[model samples]
Structures are given as C-alpha cells and as structure tokens.
Target: MGIQINGKGLLIVLSGPSGAGKGTVCSALRQQAPELVYSVSATTRPPREGEVEGISYFFKTRKEFRRMIDQGELLEWARYVDNYYGTPRRFVEERLNEGKDVLLEIEVQGAKQVKECFPEAVFIFLLPPSMDELHARIKGRGTESEQVMTDRMQAAREELNQIHSYDYVVVNDEVARACHHIRSILVAEHHRRDRIFKEQPDWLEGI
Candidate 1:
C-alpha cells in the first residue's frame, strides 16, 4: 500500500507587471484549486464602485491603518499616493496554522518581504507576451487617465527588472494556459522529494 503523506501548507506569492493579466490568472487559479486561499489586503483608499469592503479589500481609514501598524498587526505596510496598504499578519498566520495554502497576489516589493519572512514560500512572476500587448491590455481597461497609465507602464518596467528574483516566471499569453502552468507547479511542489521524505519517513527503511 502507498504510504500516506502529511503535507504542510505553502505561502504562494503571485506578482507581475500591470496589464499582464495577473488578476485574471489568479482568479482562474483559485477556481482550479479550491485549497488555495487568497489573501485580502487592507487599504486606505476609498472603496471603488461595487467593491466589497472585506472581500476585494479591507477598506480602512488612514487613522485605522496607522493604528494597525502601531500595534504591529500587519506583516508589511506601505504608503503610496497618500494612501496606505498592508497585509494582515494575524489572518495569514492563523490560516497557515490551520494547514491552509495561502496565496498572496501582491506587488514585487510585498512579495520580497514575504520571501524574506518565509524563505520556503513559492514566488511566481507573471509577464505579458510583449510590451505592445501589455499596453493594449491596460488601455482596454478604460479606467485610467493618460498620466496614470504612463505611471503604471513605468512601474511595470521596473517590476520586470526584478523577475530574476522570483522562483518561476510565467508569461500570461493565455489565461487558461497560464492557470494550468501555475496549477502544475503547485501540484509538483506538493510532491517534492524533501516534502515527501518528511511526510513518509518509513519510505526510507530500504535505504
């Protein structure tokens, strides 16, 4: 009989440039893998139209954000354009303790912090098929002004430069293919030799 395995949960970070379809890919991944838990970030920005308060993000006031930071309740916090964003440490830690695989869709900076804190966490960077395609995708959104788009494009370039730091880089040419690749990676990670060995110590008896 095959030996039963006890697998520990992993912290999976998905980061990519704007217009790379990171959100679409992540959504597909969640649908394909029910066990993967998506992290909800806390932000000081006013909730956008139809954005749920706690689902899409944990909308908070500037004062509340500062209070959370002061209490050391967040894993990583950053301020951008007069707004604050942070990952809630307690929520993630609690889920991890329950043996749930957590997925964090964040920026490269936040991904770097997660890697520093959890060296074993898996890092995946998504990329666009081409710069032209990236621009087209962003424009298709029809939500940003020229200046905001320019800023996003610039940020995307900077984020691309840090691709070497990630464990896996997937070019999201097609949503289905990209999601399949991500699922395969997670499945393969679960069957890693080190993890398998730890889970089935008796398998080493013949060695």
Candidate 2:
C-alpha cells in the first residue's frame, strides 16, 4: 500500500513601496489563483463604505488590539498614523496547518516584522520600473497634496532599501508581466527538492 504524502501550506508575503502597484498586482494574482487564501489583518481603523468584517479587516477596538499584542497573539504588528494594524497569529496558523497557502499583502513595517517571525515564508518585493515612474504613479492619483506626494516618494526610496530582504523582486512595468513573474515564482517554489521532501516526506515510502 502507498503511504499518504502530507501536503503542507505556504505563507506567501508580498510587499513593495506605496506606489509600486502592490494592490493591483495582488488583485490580479488573486483573480488568477482563487485557491490561495488572502490573509485578513486586524486593525483598529473603522470600516469605510462597503468594507466588511473578516474581509476588509478584522476590526478591533484599541483595548482588544492591545491585549492581543500583550498576549503575543499577533505574528506581526505596527502602529500607522495612530492606528493599530497587525496579522493575527491564530488566523494564519490555522489555515496554514490545513494545507492552504496564505497570501499576505503588507506594508514595509509589517513585512519586516513578519520576516523575523516566519523566515520560511516566501517574500516577494514589487518595484516600479524606475523612481520617476513611481513618483508619476503617486502624482497621477491626484488625491494627495504636492507635499504629501513628495513625502511618499521619499518613503518609497527608503523602503526600496529593504529589497535585499526579499527572495524575489518583480518590476511592475506592466501588471500582467509582473503577475506572471509572481505566479511563476510560486509554481517553481513548490517544485524545489527541499520543499518537496519536507512537505511530502512519505511520497516514496514503501515504493
């Protein structure tokens, strides 16, 4: 009789500078690969129009979020503009243990913390074709003031310094091409000899 090969899961973390089209690429990746689980983060920020609980965010009060931090219930967390946002440990672990790959799209601060907590996780950094392009993308939004845009451009430069921490980098010159690169990375990762052996130790048992 053949032994059953255990199929484990992966935690795929995607991050980039603010104007690097992280959301665009992630949304496309999800549409192409619906089987991947999208990780929902816990945040103290209130829901906006049409945002749903457990979908947009796991909305929590400041007290609740503080308790989670104190109890080590969060895998990673950060305070942004005076609001708490974090990845809950239990939520991610439960899905991972069930052989479902979880896709987490996070900011630089939160992504840095997650790298420390889960070294085995796949970390992908998305980048614009050039700094000028990134600045243009931010300016194109027109929702922010010139000063705000300048600040974001500066921050993006700082965040780019952390690209060395990621396993792969995809330049977002085109959304389709970027998505293809990311998808290829995910597929190739599953075929790595070490990963194959680790996730399915008994694949050849009794053969």
Candidate 3:
C-alpha cells in the first residue's frame, strides 16, 4: 500500500486585474473542489441587490472597519473606490486548522499585504490572454463609464508590475482550464517533500 499522508491545508491567495475573470474561475474552482473553503471578506461598502451579510461579505460600517484595523483583526486590507475591504484573520485560521484548504480572492494590493502576513500562502496571479483581451473584457461589462473604465485600465497596468511576486501565474483563458490548473497546483503542493516531511509519519521515525 502507498504511504498514508496527513497534510495541512493550503492557504491560497488568488488575485488578478479587474475583468480578468477571477470570479468566474473561482466559482468553477468551488464547483470542482467543494471541500475548499472560500474566505469571505469584510467590507465597508453598502450591500448591492441580493447580497446577504456574512454570506456575500461581512458588511461593516467604516468605524467598525477602522476598529478592526486598529485591533489587527484583518489578515489584509485595502481601500478601493472609497470603500474598505479586508479578510478577517480568525475564520481562515479556524478552517486551516481543520485541514481545509482556504481560498482568498482579493485584489493585488491586498494580496501583497497578505504576503507580508502569511508568506507561506500559495499566491496565484490570474492573467488575461493579452492586454487587448483585458481591455475588451473590461469594456464588455457595460456597467462603467468611460472615465471609470480608463481608470480601471490604468490600475490593471500597475497591477501587472507585481506579477513577479506571486508563486504561480495562470492565464484565465477558460474557467474550467484555469480551475484545473489550480487543482493541480494544490495537489502538487501537498506532495512537496518539505510538507510531507513536516507531517512526520511514525513510519519515518527510525528510517
């Protein structure tokens, strides 16, 4: 029989420029790997239509969010478009301790903050097939004004500069393919020698 292994869960951070389909890929990943925990973020923004508190986000007031920051309750946080968004520390820790892989879908800026706090997390950067494709996707949204779109494109350009800091780069050409790549990455990480040794099976004690 093959050696039995007990492995700690992986902390995965997924980030990409706007319109790169991070949400679509993540949704596919959830369907493919139902056991993985999706980390819900806390935000100061008002809820949109059909959004439920603690399900869509832990909606907090600006004062409460500021308090969380002061108390260091957040793993990472960033302000975008005059609203605060952040990941809570306790839920992630609890899930990881239960040996459940946790996925954090965040912005590049927030990902950098998370890197500082949890360097061991498997950071994945999603990329569009090309700049033209990215631009097209952003334009296709039909929800933003030309000025807002222009600003988003500019932000995307800046976010691209931080790609080197991530552990892996996955091009989101198709949702299923990208989710497959993420699943493969998790499997490979679980098989890493260091992680395997850290599990320290009794069989290895005398070898």
Give candidate 2 misplaced runs (Cα > 4 Å).
1-6, 202-207
- Per-residue lDDT of model 1, residues 1-207, tens digit only: 565443677678899998888889888888988888898899999999999976889999888999998998887778889899999887788887677888988889988877776778889999999999999989998998999999999999999999999999888999999998888888787778887777667886976
Compose the digit string of candidate 3's lDDT tens values, residues 14-133: 999999999999888888889999999999999999999878999999999999999989999998899998999987988887888999999888898889989989999999999999
What are the runs in model 3 whose C-alpha is more than 4 Å off?
A: 1-4, 46-49, 201-203
Q: Which regions of candidate 1 are displaced past 4 Å?
A: 1-6, 45-56, 59-64, 70-72, 143-147, 197-207
Q: What lDDT does the true structure give each of the candidates?
A: 0.86, 0.89, 0.90
Clashing pairs in 2: none
- Give Cα distance to truth, residue 69, candidate 2, Å: 0.8
lDDT of 1: 0.86
Locate the minimum summed-lDDT window of 10 residues in model 1. Answer: 1-10
TM-score-based ranking: 2, 3, 1
Candidate with top lDDT is 3
Which scores greater on lDDT, model 1 or model 3?
A: 3
- Using TM-score as the measure, the top candidate is 2
